[model samples]
Target chain A: MTEQRTRRIDVPVLARVEGEGALEVTIRDGRIAHLALRIFEPPRLFERFLVGHHYSELPDLVARICGICPVAYQMSALDAIERLFAPDRQSPPARWVQRMRRLFYCGEWMQSHALHIHLLAAPDFLGFDSAPAMAARYGAELRRGLALQALGNRIISLFGARSVHPVGARAGGFRRAPSLQQAGALAAQAEQAVPAAEDLVRWTAALPLPAHPQQFNCVSLRHPAEYPMIGERIVAESGLDISVDDFEDHITEFQVPHSTALHALLEGKPYLVGPLARLNLNLDRLHPGVKALLAELDIEFPSHDMYHSIVARAVEILQALLEAREILADYAPQEPAHIDLQPRAGIARGASEAPRGLLWHRYDLDSAGIIAHARIVPPTSQNQPRIEADLADALVGVGLDEDEATLRHAGEMVIRNYDPCISCATHFLRLTLDR
Target chain B: MTMPPKPPAIGARRPRLAVHKFSSCDGCQLSLLNAGESLLALAERVDIVHFAEAGIVDEHAEADIALVEGSISTPEEQTRIQAVRSRSRWILSIGACATAGGPQALRNLGDSADWIASVYRRPDWISALPASSAIGAHVPVELELPGCPVSTEQVLAALTSLLAGAAPLTEQDKVCLECKRRGQVCVLVTKGEPCLGPVTVTGCGALCPGLGRDCYGCYGPAENPEVATLAERFGDLGLDAHAVARRFMYQQSGAQPFHRAARDWRQRARPAAPPAPGAESGAAPGPQPDGSTDSHD
Candidate 1:
């Protein structure tokens, strides 16, 4: 008599993901018994500790939350603060600030998306242990990715002194403006990288990506005219549209015992965010050239395949480059880089499309502009539930009887597909199979 | 300037480098990826056996150099840092979080649960140490590269020095030295801006001062920091006690020198006096060129 075999796939270290996490799945009788993605990273309690900080310090303070995407934190915080301080939708910073902010955000998307595709996600597609291992053979391609990433940093540094925890952004506007010569040089370089970025889109699409398409809700910020970086409206492919102010109404956050990060539900279900979600929701908002490039590559948006995220990031890189080149072309430095902020007593709400997903911030401030309450919903926290859902289905696809290494690699690939910023989510990856 | 990924010599072992994380944002380790053109060569120069963020995770792998980021925030982290210490020949704690306990160290002031409950609705579910501390507090560190996110050049410079069998030279002078070297105007003296440059360490190229903002000491305390004198100067600039304490306490609150001064200043903290409506709330203090604060009085 043969006893039913129990399979347990345990990955001691989950690599290529930020922060700390362990994925546990139990399979019995060829039926999924229990599956959970747990984050063991110690809680930093950013929202709680941020209570007493002056609104002026919010940008610098929140930027520490995630090292890779400080710009997103600064932008979301500033959006809420700026909206409260400004009497209207577009004053104080005026059109120039609005344009420059988009340009700056583009830089973030470029660097972040570029970094994820080549360094983080690409290794899985190439069947290499790491990017450096992939780099030895794909020298020119790796060089191009690195150069593009640097270009993104350089563009960010143009407005911000340095990309990582940049000291440039302020509530009203920027701390300093770049010189015309600096902007022009940057514009020219961005123009040159356009071809490379285009090739990146094609190259990613050409990779041997898996055809594991799964149904998931796609959520992102939707702008009226352009691809949403900072948006007034939050949207989902499920036809759920709400004001960014009413974000808490639709999305509810819950704590899971397995993870330090909070798992979130969108209208009581899992939803996807970030590049693919942005593309699925706002494909028309992409640059005409990028849209045309997608058409050229035979890659369609509104794709259900999760592995298409790499391609989505590449397409966005091209879009960001195009946007940066245009904004920098008409570069002119403005005096009084930021507007004088008047402390107002009110609840400030802001949301922006972080490279990972929708980053939302709400701060209750006293008349002194000091924070009375603060809540930050970074993208990673929002994606944890969705990532779990993806893993359950994706793992079943990989089959329960597979070897531990195969299951671990498959699980790693599935999570990395989300580009989960465990650090941002209070997140990491260690796989444990208790079958 | 990147070298091709070729073997150094037959049977020769390249120094193994491992990156470990604790309780901070994964920024400092990211600087290694941000090395851009030189990254491939650097990867070839050293065997990167363990860097979870970069997809290589061999936690127990012995390494010639271990680059550690983040602070000790959990019991699990305490054990992990020790394991890293035992395996590594040289451990370089990078960034303010790892070397100085980072911004999270602000929790070190009291029971972490006090603030933890505020952030998480179910605080009972959270598991963290009573206080966050620098990596040095748990295990002996070979070196400390202090920065909010240590500059890319600083990381390169330190790695270069260590790879050459030498000690990395870090500036022990005040941030005022950086401003002087770049001929940047002193914001504190000229505009009464509460810049931490006079007391904080140099490393950011005096980024804040040149940008017309005060340095908030993201790089931690300088050698023989006169923070008490700097605290007094902040008071002279019309900053209230709470505001002055916040400037020193927020980023690198775990640093000894700044901690002592901030503790002294926090004593005279505000008595919960509400800010008057339309008070000067912005980038600088006192007044603006446009008289935006005309109604404040």
Candidate 2:
């Protein structure tokens, strides 16, 4: 043992993920010495840009932040701003708006999740370089995946008029309600796809994921009555429950040296967010249909194995589809799609579960409905520390002395497992090696 | 130049396609993915050697056509775009970010360092340039398709034409033209909505205007058009000088025509010198309202 060998593993630009990021694993004494998930996705300075805009513009404006989950941004922004301008939110009309929002969010989760499972994560398990590279062999499965994704897009477009950066959502409600004819047709389609979604869960469960379980706190929004798409309060596996407004107090977002995105430490410790975390904490809140589907699968929630993330995503797609079907089934053409609001002043904070995880927004508005300042805490930033932690633990599990390519692949799988929305976080990865 | 569109793969090697990102929402890339089966069919027609989001990460891979998204916002990105240009035969800059500098380019009108400090805790950790710029500002762009998320139709049409070795048709017609062509009653004229359709290029089929909302110029300026006049009209529509200036500055703030129009309006409206893009960068509208305020209240 004259000199402990030193080497480095480098992934210059992370592939098959949402936004740009890099990872570096340093091997010293044949153990993982250092790990950094460098989120190099350029910060667009969204909060600063929001400063002078009118309250009405927020939905469309924040939607531009991340194309993958524009709905989440729109929903969260509206949730904050609307809660400020309009106090009477429990009226029948307001409840109508809430139901529509939940349905719209369902579409987004469906599209985002289907995309992750098929195009991004599936190839990793199937031993292919890319989804298209696996196209010829897995044609039907790929088509099924795309079809589900297309259906999700249709549901979003039904309300949004276009899926990516949809223009439908507004302060009080939507810009316009989708027609009954279109809404009914989509509901019928969603109903038929429930079994297809169930198939997806089984399909993901069969994937040869690595059985590497680790301990980390799981956090998600937990509502009393429903699986929270728009949540009331956040509850973690460690029983750290708090209101969305208390977020800044409990979850401190501090800048890190290696990444452009800030690292979020919940009470100064790394905690997990996104589908796995949501499933672990709120498995009981899932719809009966979803629960039955889960009952058929062997993998149970509260699963600490990070690979179960893909399975979580599949389960969520089913959950979204089932809910979308139920809500859309009774859809009607309302006279006015949106509720009008008078301008006012105050701090506005709203939180919702994006497909990736919790998205929280706080806006300070002037009396004239102008945004004075804004701050957004996207999920990927919160998960950054946890990702680095998981990478260090899992890298050793796969053997530290393994060749660079093997380690690189394993590292990518772990990150993609989170389905990290790096662009949303001012976020994401690229990897480098040192030994 | 107008070689009758011969089907691609006549006798030459299949063209390779690559997609790249700089600083964007990843919408434009998703537009390609959103093409669904057509995208998979595209994989058959060409080698998709790289597209980071969809799992091909051959960074140095060469290609016939490269679809680049996002704005160049950092020193490293300035160097990176040149490498992308060197590797690809044809480069199509997609979305407002890649073509017009996007909304982030609003800060291009201000000191970016100041903006970063206002937005982030540790400004030292963030590596950003003074200004965000379109890819063409740094490198030669074969074509620029401007949209907030870019139109999938335009991207698909461009792909087909480029693969056929023909120049993809670039639409320079104003949104007003498309709006009228689609029989949308002028919201600006009829409803006194401050629409940007007359100045904005047609790509979205005048979608916002059709939706009875003012055209926000998601697709930058349509070649050379009457921007100042339209912006002036916004003031006449009961908007104050600040509101009028912001319309031009909001979406494609770094595009030359819109940038100039916004600056001119702000200058004319203010007696004193106009402030920077985010004049109150350090401003935080105070703190919490005793922490929580529910809707029921």
Candidate 3:
């Protein structure tokens, strides 16, 4: 009789994914038996602390949930509180304020994508230990990436008052608006970075991506007039479209014994969100220049190829740069950056496209505008289940007989494709083997 | 000032720099990456043995300088920090979270398990200490840089100073001083806003006040802050006692001075007469006439 073969692989710590986590995979009799992605980061319990705070504090308070995407948190919180205070959809902030909000979001996308593409994910593809190591061979590319990231930070500072955890955004609109001169200066910077972003797109499009195609339920916010960065409805390719108010009803979060970050399921199944989902759902809504560039590059959309996320991020960087330039060209300083509104008892919901994917926030305010309860669902948590599913499937494809390094590398690639913000997800994993 | 002793030189080896995370938003460490050109320059001078955010992993590697971000809020983390301390020659606690337990430290005000129950359906699955604490509380720290997310310039400067065998010089002055240096008008005086600039630290370059908003005290507290005076000033600016307490309690609730001030203001905000039976209502402590609730208690 053949002896029963058993093997276990332990990734003691996961690197470059923000915060700490580990992955454990066990194989028995040449079949994958057990897998777990553990998140061991201590719980901050932001939702609980948010209780008893004033409505005005929600934006700033929620921003602390994730440093990499503070703008997403602020935007979501503002949307929810503003909807509650101003139920009339017609009475949204002035066109300029709305435009500035998108522009601010553009900065975040640029900064986050640039960081991930150059510093975090690129190293994996290049077979380097880290970006610093890659810099030795790709010096010019690294500089361009940093310059683009710096430009993003500048734009964030112009509106947010600081790059990380910006305090400029408030419940109604913003704490203050930048002057025309300031906006013009930023526009000049954006113009300078446009060529670099174009180069980035071309470069990423040329990368040697692995062909690991798989069916995915792509999810993103959708709007009628434009590509959705901030929108009212959550749409999925699998015939799932619901109002932001019904998000909790559609998506459920459950705690797994192995991970501190709660896993999320859409209609009781894993789904994907982020650049790929946004592009897939709103290909027609992309800017004309973006479409023209894609056409020139002979690239197709709605592809199931996960590795193409790097290229998608680069395309977004270009789009964000162009959009920022256009918005800043018509810059005007508006009075009353924020409108004063009395908070009333009500529940409100907000959702916006963070760099990674859709970030949703819900708040319950009391009669006196004090927060009675708060719930925040960051993109990373929503992607956690999807990442695990991708891992299990990819491992099966890679075969259990492969070396542990090969399996670990494949697993890291899958996780990094989602740009998982473990800090935002509030967890890490410690892989242990019992063989 | 007398010059400090120069760090001993290793014959042929560069210093190994390691960055550790506990419970933070990852912003403070990102500041190092945000340094851009300066960070690359620093990388040339030192070996980055471990920085998970940067894709570098060397968990057990010994470091010459260890920059720690976030606060300790779990038993496992407490053990991890001690292990990091044992392997490092110098440990510099970075950001508000590492220096004063961060905004999440607000959980220290109430039971952490209760907070978990309020947020999650299965609180039994959660494992956390009762209070979030700064790194210094568990082990010795060579230095502390305080900010909600520390400024990138400060991070670069600290690194440069350390490389040059000098102590990183940090100013302990209030944000008000920085505002004055920048020739900016006081939002508190001009707009009658409840700014914490007078008591908050200055590393942020007076960012909030310069943007025409009140200082929200993201830098925690300055050295020997006169919190009672600021509370009195806030009271004069139409903030009720509860509101005044909240200003101190929100961001740096775990810091000693801020924590004490919050408690003192809450005491002052208490009603002169006890509430009648059935009047508790479970409503937040004080309700202002302006339709805002001040529920610090």
Among all windows of 10 consecutive residues in model 2 chain A, the one with the lowest summed lDDT is: A426-435
Whole-model alpha-carbon lDDT for candidate 1: 0.82
| DockQ for all candidate structures vs. native | 0.37, 0.38, 0.44
Give a tens-digit lDDT track for model 1, residues A93-151: 56688888888888999999889988899999889988988987888998899899999
Query: Ten-residue segment with the worst summed lDDT in candidate 3 chain B?
Result: B288-297
Minimum summed lDDT over a 10-residue window in model 1 chain A is located at A426-435
Error of 3 at A143 (Å): 1.2
Report how far off residue A95 is in candidate 2 (Å): 1.1
Q: Native contacts recovered, in order, as a fraction for each?
A: 0.69, 0.60, 0.68
Q: What is the DockQ of candidate 2?
A: 0.38
State how far residue A366 of model 1 sits from its true place (Å).
Answer: 0.7
DockQ sort, best first:
3, 2, 1
Q: For this target, which candidate reaches the highest DockQ against the unseen true structure?
A: 3
- After superposition, the stretches of candidate 1 with alpha carbons farther than 4 Å from their true spots are A1-3, A89-93, A427-435, B1-12, B270-297
Model 2 lDDT tens row, A49-88:
7777778888778998899999999998888877667657
Where model 3 places Cα greater than 4 Å from the true spot, the runs are A1-3, A87-93, A427-435, B1-11, B267-297
TM-score of chain B of 3: 0.88
Ordered from best to worst lDDT, the candidate numbers read 2, 1, 3
